[model samples]
Target: MDFKLTDEQVKLRKEFYDVCKDLEKRKPHGFAGLESIYDTDEGWEYHLYCAREYAKKGWISIGWPPEYGGKGTIGDKVFFAEARGYYDLPGIDIFGPEMLAPTLLGVGNEELNKRFLPGIASGEVQWCELWSEPNAGSDLASLTTSAVRKGNEYIINGQKIWSTGAHRAHWAFALVRTDPHAPKKQMGITFILFDMRTPGVTVKPLYYMDRAHVYNEVFLDDVHVPVENVVGQENEGWRVTQLLAGFERSSLGAIMMMLRQLEELVRYCNETKVGGKLLAHDPLIRNRLAQMACEIEALRCLGYRIADAQERNEMAGFEASGVHILASELQERLSWLGADILGPYGQVKRSRWSPFDGWYEKWYQQSFVLFIAMGTNEIQRNIISWYGLGLPRMK
Candidate 1:
């Protein structure tokens, strides 16, 4: 593949970067991590403002089908992601555009698509995932959340833990057990969407170590959802779940964020001296940084390949898992390296002595989340082994 961009793509890239750079200038102080969107009112308002700006430009719908208001190709989507990642912008809601929209485009009924796509494209609707439960995170098939059909609606009941941004989400896409008696555990699951303000739904915060309110525990007690809200066939949501999982894995935005952070770290090393020696001149630091740069570049290439495959409507099953593993582990490694370079200063959070406005400290605490989120790295490795390597399952 020729890595060079076309003339049109080059122009689009420049426009995306220019707009994001301007937005970056106006962003709130300490708006560093994804959690900031839900952790504070200022961050949340900034996120809404950015989303509205992107919506007006049709940036949020760039990758959608033209009939659904999309006006660009997958490459355009990649460029937009790169811009957002580099600038650490939060206009786009990951659960909505990044995950659910593509899945809906692939498997949803015509009515569902027509009804939901506009809300997402306009950036008026924010979404959250309600998949993980206290007992069914990694082994998601074991989830006990129930959704029983009753005429034109389904009654849902159960709890979902570790739901990111649930407290602020306008809607949610979730998996529930529609048939507990199916012969196989995964066979009985169903995918459904519902309003967050449903009478029986409740959301409570699960504050992080940094006291950030990004994650939540959502409880559904006899919540009612229309049967038409079910995506694909009932009891076959596992297929939809797997399809959405592919979209969740290739995180180009995250790779871009790490790239920006890497550049900042390099600048710090060049300008800051320790014990009369420039940190950049240290052989060990230079070697580590070089290795990280190589890994990040390779991951970026992998991301581009995935986007190309998606453009062609091909499924990148094991390759998506590979991206997930590399991206998550690379982030963890990069954060560890940042902590090492910053030493004692890295531990300080939002204080006068903290470097990069305490970004490294927050990053160090949150880097571990990617490993566990969107399926654990250990599970991703098993996927690579089974699908990529054609290895037999271990019973």
Candidate 2:
């Protein structure tokens, strides 16, 4: 594929970078890691501020269709994502724009998009995902979050764990079992959306080993959700879920963030002294950084390919898992390399002694999240082999 950018695309990307870099200067001091942006009230406020700023620029939904408040091409969406990652800005949740909006466009009625898309496009409503559970995270088909129909509404009662940003979200999209007695687990699932303020809904914060509060466990106790809120047919939610999952796995935002971290790591190596010389002069560190740069470029190109695929409107395929696996595992490896470079300073957190103000430390702590989130790396490999490569289907 030709990677050349047109003049208009170049201009758009530069404008996005300028705006995001300016926003970076305005963000709170201690905001570095992705979770740090949502872990505190100050951080959350900064996120909302950045979100509103980006919304004013109309940069949130550049890839959405023209009729749905989107005015830019898919290439523009890459610039927007790069801006977010370069600045570590918040307010862009995958559940809403990147994940749900695409699925809704594919299968939702006009009323659904008219009501929900506008809020998401404008960043008026933030969304959380409710797919993982205590026992059925990677094996989401076995999820037992049951939603029993009652007239015009469904009474949802179950628990969802590892729900990122649920504590701060105004809304959520979830997979619940609509037919408990179905012959197959995947056959009975239903995709539903509801207000986070529903009567029986409860969100409790779960901290990382480092004491961050970006993830939560959500309990739905008889939460009433109108049938109208279902994304597609009630018992046919699995198909809609598959559609959204494809979009979710196609995200390359984290890869851009890794690129940013790499820049910082290289700068650190240049300035920090070891054995009477800068770390950058060390042959071992130089080799490691070179290898990381190659991997990051590979992932970035994969991102470009996926974005190009989305541009063509032929995205209902199995390539997303392959992209997701390579990108997610690269995060872990990058963090590990950073940790090795920092030595004891890498383990330090928010301390005067920590290197790079404990950013690498926080990065190492949270990078493992990618492995588990959006399906485990093992699960993604299975999807790639069976769905994409067509090697074999699990019985």
Candidate 3:
């Protein structure tokens, strides 16, 4: 299917690009660095300030739908196009708006949607996903967190790990067991949102090998969430989570961010001398760069194809999984190449105010976290196997 955009769609994309043109000028921090600095409360506040500036500059989508605090606008093709372009520029994490917005628009209650959607759209409220735990990382249905009914409130008590951006988030949309005795593990859970400030909630930082606190361990003890916080029907959070995961994987790769990394890699190779000759001139290094360039083109086109399918409201399970697998592998290879090219200098943390702020150096150590987070490559393969190849489960 040729997923070409119309003239108006193209124009809208240009407008978004125009607004995002100065992204690089805004800040040096991208996904990898942003999380690294989110340890202190003040750091999170600074992050929020930057996000608010983006929103105020019309870089966000606040006037989306009245139900979810948006203007009730319908623009999927434009959204996907804008998202891919947004990342090319200096972009804050758009996961909350991109992943959760559609789900809320599709299934959230009018009141619940109105209250949370506007803030989310305006960058006033940040969100995190509390789906995975230590035991139930890949096999999410095996989650043991329970939320028993207590009058109009459901008392939640459990642990959630790898909650990206949870340390500074205002709220979280999580899955919990409402009917543990149900026949299938996937059948008895519900999707719910909770305020981070609620009592009985604790967020502990989880630092990566690179010395950045990008992830967290959240403990919810006797937390009380109102019944109104639940999204869709009871015992159906599994389905909601599946849908969201599909959204996550579908957005695996876009040309913008990868292209930025590629440009940096090329420069590093040209300046750094190996055997007194530029690394870029070396045949082996050239070949690797060529291979990565080809792979990036393939990933870019593949993302457009997936976006087209999603725009049509198609069942995107398999297509999304395929994209995830490709992007994850490509990222790993590129990260390894970057570290190799940087040599000893890649391990150092350059002073930001001094000079060449060592982005490549930091990226080398930090990029590995991407593969393990956001659904591991191993889990992506399992999804493709079960859904795409019709493989039988392990006995």
Candidate 4:
């Protein structure tokens, strides 16, 4: 359980940082967050450009098997993520390499792997998750979206809500009901993938309060998907769903983003004077900043622990939930602190008067998304209690 990076890992870490730093310099002004890839034409092009750059280095498949274009270990993947987070770079699609690739490696058949892995590794295809339905978010097993087999294809008809970047995705991995007669709701479910451009598929914008089009409502009306697109086995998608969830929650990128923001805030406080005194000199500000630093460090350590577990091929299950809860809550706190530090200017966005290009303003408005996305913090707590603490589930 040594936390130190080996000499080679240290060199690889430096390489990641050096490349990301150069990329950061070329980033368009106002380029922030994954939503940028979907909200503006320039942003989307820039995202694709960065993706190609990383793909050329074989970085998108860093943690995959060598046959699939992968050449690095899981630890290398972690370092790359940290570098991207610290620099606020966006090239890797979280739905693709971060979640689906590993899941495919673990459960997909040879045909499925050979067909899809190459596209993802090459960064030639982007993906979205169509998991949540209007009435089936937290209780996803209750989803009623059906995919009935018809010859060699499954005819899909349903709706998916809160699908992030759906309008920009080339393909989507989704959960659907393939069997209505199964004894349990979870038993009837299936995991499948299909092209977004498939006939009968439609995507509509679901704008944020700030009018950002980062999410969408995706509709399927007899969308034809090849039966071969199914991941793992039909009528047992809940297990696949659970497996992907582990990767989703084990992300360390957000934590590194917070660290960068914290560093920026510290610099601002040290240089800016308020009431004829440095903000850093204010005891109250110092106390809050110090507290956030410590919390962020704790989360970083926890992330490393989870990554270590993953390297050992162990199920991080509840540990991933723990990281999710802490990281999301910490972000909320950090955003609030930023707003407080900036006062009224914090509320401004994309304006000359706003500080830090109003990044904090937008962040404060959207920080609550993580509380509900992927899964709710309340649900995460239940996972921690039930799995980590060995507590009984209340019937």
Candidate 5:
């Protein structure tokens, strides 16, 4: 329950915030929104620029063990996330550093960690997830992607859709059916890593509604991966997948983004008048904003509790899923509120007509994606009900 930071953590957190604040000032001319991440080459390059900077300063290695070059705790990681999300900084990749490194620490061989951890920690490489497919998004265990093993390698052949950052990533960690004849759907699956530039690997764009190419459809045709790329046992990747999914869900970045958006909302309301009264003065807007504030605070508290549980090695609970569902749904709700407040102005960004530089406009369009990414909120709910509450399975 004690959420106070130690003096050292406080100093470290401020350093991270100062760096992000400075980056915000020095960002590219058109780098005001996440849209820049996918809509223009400048945006992409700007992201890489940020990535290298984070790598150089070791921000990317927060909370990792000292042996792995990490020099902070779980609290320090949360503090850094708030700064990154507040500034909406680019360059800190979620897939490679955030999701995979933790998974490796949990289940990978020393050699695997020694090989992959450095690239991610150094931010020299970027990674993507290859989990969902045309028909296996929510029902991920049913994924049909196959990685057939030979003596020394696995020949992977399948398709993965809705892969975020796949088009721009240097590598991917995929779940493939290594043994098709296993008795259960979740059994016999393998977690494998491979270079995106390998032969017969194709990445085609799957743009958002606003035509931004942040997600992609990755096709693998007889792609070959060395046995060393497998993270654990050849066919027991489900456990690692679950572990990684928990990390993805518990990531505090989304909550931090919502916190920043709330601040922007308050500022807009204070400055804008509607019907001869400031928007902040409207009862309905005030109520909605208040509700969002409550939800965000609760989410932040939950994040801290989860981090504490993780620190204690006592997080054998549904808190991760709970945080994911709350954060993603809250993001969607915030986006909708912003759109409703902005009215038509919310629909446009980078134009003089848009408020907040059309930042929420992009968020409004992509809001629903957050609920489904990492894993669907529906799935998270089911997990909470069945596992957390001990509810019986649905027929």
Candidate 6:
């Protein structure tokens, strides 16, 4: 496959990189320079304000179509890579514009697209995915959340766990069962978006081991939504969900965060010494670093390959699944390497003697959560086995 980017794509990517450079240069000092500065509500408020200002400056549309107030720039992988390389941005909630945009643009009604796409692309609105019900995770089609149609509205009632960023998001794109008697488990599902501020919608904070409120439990209690919010045909949401999950898995931007963490690991290893020598000088640590670098390069190429397939309108079924699985695993491994480099400090969360500005201190604590987010590695492997390899069901 050719590794060349077109002239226009190259130009747009360079422009994106330039903008990120400016954002990085102008970013606030203190805790803002950290990987995830917006862990707190107050910190997020400031981050959102920055995001809004960045949006107004047209700094938020690398993956959206032009008709939806975006630059309609293609070659999203190139643009995202350039942005991450230029700016130290932690890549939070990037799926909203990249993964969710494609799903909405492809299947959403004209009205729905027109109403939400612009705001979404502009960073005026934030969206969270309400997937992973208690009983249904990897087997997402087995979801039991119910959305019954009545007049021009659908009343939804269900509980969604591990809804990332729902506490800060303005809306949610969720899957619900609109048909109880559908022939197949996947047949009754529908994809819909609803306001998080609606009555009967309860948001319960779920704290991680590090005492960070990142994930949430969202309860929908007979919440009413306009029928227009539904994407594609009723009871066909499973297909849309499949496509969306593919987008999420295939996205190249997720690895950028890992890339940043890798840089931090190198710096920490070099600065922290053991046995009167730098940790980076150790053979085992050096080998681990070399392995991480190689894996990251491979993952980067895989991401670009997915993007190339997307540009050619090819279905990247198992490749995307494998990429997602590999990326998350590499992230966890890198975090473990960080903890190892820190030694006893690996387990510490808050202290005056932490290294890497206490970044690894936090990552060492929250590394497990990375494996389970979006979808677990087990789910990803199942997708590859069943969908990619055409494996037989166990039962």
lDDT top scorer = 1
On residues 1-395, what C-alpha lDDT tens digit does candidate 5 reach at each position?
Answer: 68777788778888989999998886777575455765677788888888888888887888888888887777777888778888888777778877899999989488988999999988788898899999998888999999888889899999999888888889899999998999988988999999999998999998767677778899999999999999988889898887764553335766887888899899999999977899999999999999999989988888888887877777854778888877878888999999999888888876778888777778777777768777788888988998889999895
- lDDT pick, better of 1 and 2: 1
My TM-score estimates for the predictions, one after another, are 0.97, 0.95, 0.86, 0.97, 0.94, 0.88
* Model 5 misplaced stretches (Cα beyond 4 Å): 29-35, 248-251
Regarding TM-score, does 2 or 3 come out ahead? 2
Candidate 2 residue 389 C-alpha distance from true site, Å: 2.3
The collision pairs in model 4 are: none
Residue range 1-395, candidate 3, lDDT tens digits: 67576787677667555545544344444333455336555456555665676667444563355434344123443453345444543224545676676677667567866777667667788888898988998778889899999999999999999888787778898989999999999999899999999999999988777567768999999999999899888899877766675553334324556766787778878887877999988898899888898998888777766765665666558777777777767766776777667676655576543113666666556666656666777777887888889998675
Ranking by lDDT, best first? 1, 4, 2, 5, 6, 3
Per-residue lDDT of 173-213 in model 6, one digit per residue for the tens? 98999999999989999988888998989999887765777
Candidate 3, which segments miss by more than 4 Å at Cα? 1-7, 28-37, 40-46, 57-59, 62-95, 248-254, 351-356
- Per-residue lDDT over 121-158 for candidate 4, one digit per residue giving the tens place of the 0 to 100 score: 88889999999999999899999999999999999999
TM-score for predicted model 2 compared with the true structure? 0.95
Q: Number of clashes in model 2?
A: 0
The Cα error of candidate 5 at residue 191, in Å, is: 0.7
Pick the winner on TM-score between candidates 1 and 2: 1
lDDT of 5: 0.83
Q: 132-247 in candidate 2: lDDT tens per residue? A: 99999877899999999999999999999999999989999999999999898999999889999999999999988878898999999999999999999988988887776556
- RMSD to native for every prediction? 1.3, 1.7, 3.4, 1.2, 1.9, 2.9
Candidate rank order under TM-score: 4, 1, 2, 5, 6, 3
Which model scores highest in TM-score? 4
Find the 10 residues in a row with the least total lDDT in model 3. Answer: 68-77
Predictions in order: lDDT: 0.90, 0.84, 0.70, 0.89, 0.83, 0.73
Writing each residue's lDDT as its tens digit, candidate 1 over 271-383 gives: 99999999999999999999999999999998998988877868558778888888998999999999999999999988889999988888888888888888899999999
